[model samples]
Target: MQLIGLWALIAATLGPFQNVLGWSISGALVQGYDPISKTISDLAADDSPVKWIQSSFFLAGSVLTLIAAFSAKSLALPGRVALFLAGISGFGYTYFPTALVAPSPNWHVIFATIAFVLFSAWPLLSMRFDKRYHWSLRPLAAISATLVMGATTLWFLLTWLEPGQPIVGLSERVIAVMQVLWLSFVIWSQWLHQKKGAPETAPELAYGAKN
Candidate 1:
């Protein structure tokens, strides 16, 4: 149960985490959708001077979570690799000032999306496997993952859809709230189902691990 709380807490931290990092460095609130908007904006003002403090903050948090997911035994090799990539990408974006105001080489964004997708899916897959074959946490995992993935998807949609309009509009904020809250629940579920008695260790899918 305590472990459960730990997972939820970590998941919940992401929202305020980014907000503080962005505001501290940029001196302004960033788009909840982009999360990295403030960082990039600061760079644009100064030819994008690298914000090591803020960037490292984000990277460290992400890496810690990835480690927890691994420690929790919810992620496997593929998910770990993807997470590593995500961390690297995040670090690059935050640590290096890009000439473009927004992230360029659109493919970088795509890769990040893929990372998050895998991140969200692993838990869902683990829960399903547990519920169907092992009577584990499949249902809870699925529901939690669904909520997170849906929210993340909405984030992508809102931020990418209409650039002329604000990225952190009402719809996007709503999705961010949902993502944070539900992702917390998913983490809690992972903590709850971390063990299924004896040799039947938890699934790697929970932590975005791939076979």
Candidate 2:
């Protein structure tokens, strides 16, 4: 079962990863900067396989995650389902056409933002699943999620590099990195939760102590 879960994770990463979402949804940035003189259109072009990679990876990951979560009750069933839903919604939003123009990604970005929030909460909710889950990691994940969510919400009032700056892509990239860390921590934490009672003689051996 562990091998199956790990394999599913690796397979999902082969093509369907969450990061490509930004490629499709963040397309608006490219469109916003589009100019006849500009030579970067190919970067965000839909013709690229970035969408396929993201959509497929996430699709596969969602299915695998569902299977993994179901097979292992170490995490809360509801939380896992929410995570699965978040992953599913993320794939859907990645390709949805919200922009009539070349690369307007508003719709994808909007829905993806919600998906990110859901994804971030998966770890925190996961602690509710098993008593052996690392309590320390739960608080850390919660704090990270809260910070990311709050910062993203207040992005309008506080610009990353200042409003109307000549180049403004750095902030989004930074935020993306932060999101990646937050998500990685969440998933890794669940993986750890799965490990909490592996050595137990019985499933209830150390559930409360580990909690």
Candidate 3:
């Protein structure tokens, strides 16, 4: 599961970069378009010479993410469920390739919105205030992580909602990068906690043990 999280982090971080690079190298994309508002499906549109590259990234990443979602024992049921849906949503690009000039596309936006909301909410939903779990899963840490993620997502939405927003791409990238980093941190902390094999006792019990 830790390995899966690591791979997911890598894919999420690099996939966008690779997609943008492929599009630029192909010279088929319009200059100065908002990458975030364009939707990832736009990168895989029929007109794009680099469609295969961007499509493959989302497809492969989604499959890997689906596997990780099911296999991660560290996450609670809610988190796993949220991740499962998010992973499935990643396939929207391939399944609903948006036409380059369409005023309104199909499933792409719907799926993306679902994935974004669930991903933003999962950290808080996954919190388990138990002595047996790692500190990352504790209420305080989980709430803090959720707040940071939620705030970034809100920023993205705020920019996206504004007319002629120039920095939507930047906001989107920030949200994606932060999600990857937070997932990595949580998984790494859980991995270390497992390795240490030190069971956490309740505060009262630990104080009694000291005497």
Residue 211 local lDDT, model 1:
39
Q: Could you tell me which residue pairs clash in candidate 1?
A: 43-48, 74-207, 76-209, 79-208, 79-210, 122-205, 127-138
Q: Sort all candidates by lDDT, best to worst.
A: 3, 2, 1
Q: What is the lDDT of residue 33 in candidate 3?
A: 47
Question: What TM-score should be assigned to candidate 2?
Answer: 0.53
lDDT of 3 by residue, 82-108 (tens): 878888887874677656555464566
Winner of 2 and 3 under lDDT:
3
Model 2 scores what on Cα lDDT? 0.47
Write the residue-wise lDDT of candidate 1 on 123-166 in tens digits.
45445443313233356655665566656766655564456554
Q: Which stretches of candidate 2 lie over 4 Å from their true place?
A: 1-4, 7-73, 98-106, 129-131, 153-168, 189-211
lDDT of 2 by residue, 2-77 (tens): 2115643443343224444434443444445432222111233365434444355445544554554454344456
lDDT of 3: 0.66
Candidate 1 Cα deviation (angstroms), residue 138 = 1.5
Residue 151, model 1: lDDT of 68
The lDDT per prediction is 0.46, 0.47, 0.66
Predicted model with the maximum lDDT = 3
Best by TM-score: 3
Candidate 3: count the clashes: 0
Per-candidate alpha-carbon RMSD to the true structure: 8.2, 7.2, 4.9
